[model samples]
Target: MFKPLKGLLVLDFSQFLSGPSAALRLADMGARVIKVERPDGGDLCRRLYISNLELDGDSTLFHSINRNKESVSTNLKDPADLQFVRKLIEKADVMIQNFRPGVMEKIGLSYVTVKEWNPLLVYGTITGYGQNGPWKNKPGQDLLVQSLSGLAWLNGDADQPPVPFGLAVADMMAGGHLVQGILACLVRRGITGQGGLVEVSLLESTLDFQFEVLTTHLNDGGKAPQRSSVNSAHAYLGAPYGIYETKDGFISLAMGSVTELGELLACGPLAAYADPASWFAERDEIKAHLRDHLKQGNTAHWLGILEPAGYWCSDVLTWQRLLEHEAFKELQMTQHVKRDNGAELITTRCPIRIDGEIYQSAIGSPKIGEHNDKIKQEFGGVVRE
Candidate 1:
C-alpha cells in the first residue's frame, strides 16, 4: 500500500488512550512511531485492563493501541536520559503528549521549550480541560470528562441518572481531533517550512462531538434536550428514531415519515400522526405505539417490510452475530498481529482504506525499551554511564 507518512518520525509521549491513539493512526498511515516511557514501568496503560484478559504480561488494551510502534524507556528525571530524549526530540517530526497542564512544563518538555529544540516539530497536546482553567488539574479520565462535558446527559432514559457512554468516547474524540490538528500543522509545515502547536482537550472534543444537538439547544431558546420516554435513541430526533424490541430480537429505526412507517408496518396507531411537528410533540406516544407494534413481529419480519422501501432501518445485532455474518467478513476488518516471541493477538485493523488498499501490519507492540539499543545506534544518542 502507498503510505503517505512513511518517512515521518512520530514520538509518542502520551500514555493510555488519547495521545497514543493519535500516534496509532499516524503509524497506521506509515509513520514510524516510538513510544517514550518511564523506565520503571513504562506506560501506565500496560496495566490498565478493560477485562481480566492480558497478553505477554500486559493488558490487551496496551497491545491494541500500541501496535506498529517502538518503545524507548527513559526516566525523564535522570539528566542523562532526559538529554538523550532531547536528542531524539530534536530529530522527531511530531510529538504527542497528554500529561496534565504543568507536568510537561516542570519536566522541561513543554511545547514552548521543545519547539526551540526542533523548530519544525509539530507539538500536539491533550489535556482534561485545557491549559489554564479551574479544571486544568482535574483527572483527564474518559468517564470524568464525559460527565463534566455534559455528554452523560445525552445518553440513557430521561428518568434515569446521567449515563456515560460504555466506551471511552471522550478520549477517542480528543485523539481524533489531535490527529486532525497534527495533520493540518504538518500540511502547513510542508508549505511554509514551519511547525506549530496543536492542542485538544477531552472536554472540548466531547463538546464538539455534540455540536449538532448543542447547536439546536443554542438556537431553540436554550431548552434542555427532551429524551423520548420510550425507545429513545437520539435526544433531539423524533419518533421511530430508536431501537424497538421485536418478537425474536430488536430493530433500529431512523428518521422517516410516521404515517409511511405505520402503513408499512401495518401499525394502525401510527396513522394518527401525519403532521411532522407531531413527530416531536407526540414522539413519546408515537414511540410507545411503535415499541408495542414492533414487539408483535420478529426482527426479520419487520426488516423484510422496511428495508425494501429504503427506509433507514436495521436489525440490531450482537458482536457474535455481526462478526459471523457474511457482510462483516467481506470487510476483512480484523487482522492477526504477533509479538517477537510468537504470541499473537486477533484485533481489528485500522478502519482506513487509501486508494482501495487496506493497511495491516504483522508487528505487535514492543516491550518497554525494546528498541533502545537499535534507536541509540540509529539516532547516535549517548546516555551518561
Candidate 2:
C-alpha cells in the first residue's frame, strides 16, 4: 500500500533517542531514512544495559526505536568521507540531527552548508537548549530539562524533596515536536517549493508540557498550585479519592465531587456516607470511614464492585500485567519485529492509525555502518546503487 511519505529521502544524523525516534517515524511512514553514525561504536543505545532480553552485543532498546532505516558510518574528519556526505545531502529531502549546539556547523554539514548543496533540504535539529540560549552549549539531559523546567518541583509530596519523573518525558516530547516541525515544513515546502530549517529544543519542549501550570499562573494572577502528594490530589474536600490499599493489592478510587461520592455511597458499606454535605463538617471521620471500608477486600473485588457502580476506579497493574492485558491486544499497541538473526521481539509501533490500520515496517535497525557499501556505491560519483 502507498504511504504518505513514500519516495522521500531522509538523512538521519541523530543518535540515541530524540533524533532517531523522529527519523523512525518518517521511515515507518515510508520515507527512505539513512542513519549516519561514527566509526567508533555508533549510537550509545547499542551498549545500553538491558537485563530482561538476550542481545547480540547490541541492546534491545537500540532496536526497539530504530527500526525501518539504513545506517552508514563515515569519518567526517576525512576529506573523502566528507565529500561522500555532501553527495548524500545533495539528494536528501530531509536531514535530522540532535547534537550539541554547534557540532554540525563544526563538521561543515550545517544548514548553511547543506542548503548550499540542496536549497530545498529540510534541516531538522534537536538540541538541549535552543541555538542562541545561554544553556545551548551546556550538556542537556532529560533529568536536567525536567529539573530546570519545574517538573521535579511539581512532582512528589509537599514535605519531600523534588522527585524525578520515571520516564524520559523531555526527550520524547522533543522528538514528537521535531516530527511536527518536520511535517509542517514539508507542507510549507510542498506549497511554496521552499525548504527551511526546523528546530526543536529539549528545554522548550519540557516547558511546553507544563503549559497548564504556566497558563494558569499567568491567568490567575500568579497563583500557583501547591505541590501535593499524589494521594492528596482530590482529598482537599471530604470526597474519597486516592489509591486505596486492598487485601491483596491497590486500586485507584476517585469518588470526588458530591455526586460521585453519592454514587459510591450507594454500594452497601459506603452507603452510610450518601449525604456528603452533612459530613462536610466531619471530613476526617468520613474519609477514615471510607478508608476502613476499602481495606475489607482485594483490588479485583473493589474494581469489580466500584467500577461497575459508576465510581471511577481501577486496579493498579504492574508492567507485566499491563503488557499481558486484553486491552493491549485489543488496541494493537505493540508489534513483533523479526531480526536479522531470525529472532523477534515485541516493540511499540506508531500511535497514529490510518484507514483503521496501524502502519508498520519490517526493517530492523542497521548494524554500525551496515549500509556503507550501499551508500558508498550510490554516492561515490563513479558508482551508483
TM-score for all predictions? 0.98, 0.88
Clashing pairs in 1: none
**Highest TM-score against the true fold, candidate:** 1
The clash numbers for all candidates, in the given order, read: 0, 1
After the best TM-score superposition of candidate 1, give how far the Cα of residue 254 lies from its true spot, in angstroms: 0.5
- Of the candidates shown, which would achieve the greatest lDDT relative to the real structure? 1
**Over the full model, what C-alpha lDDT does candidate 1 score relative to the true structure?**
0.92
The sequence of per-residue lDDT tens digits that candidate 2 reaches over residues 1-385 is 7888999999999877888889988988889999888888888878865466545667887888788788888877878778888898999999999989878889999998888899889999999999886788877688898998888877754567877788878989999999999999999999999899999999999999888777877787776655433344332334455566678888775645544554544435445655767444445455555666667777787677666767677888899999899997788877777667766767888888777767876667777887788778777731112
Clashes of 2: 1
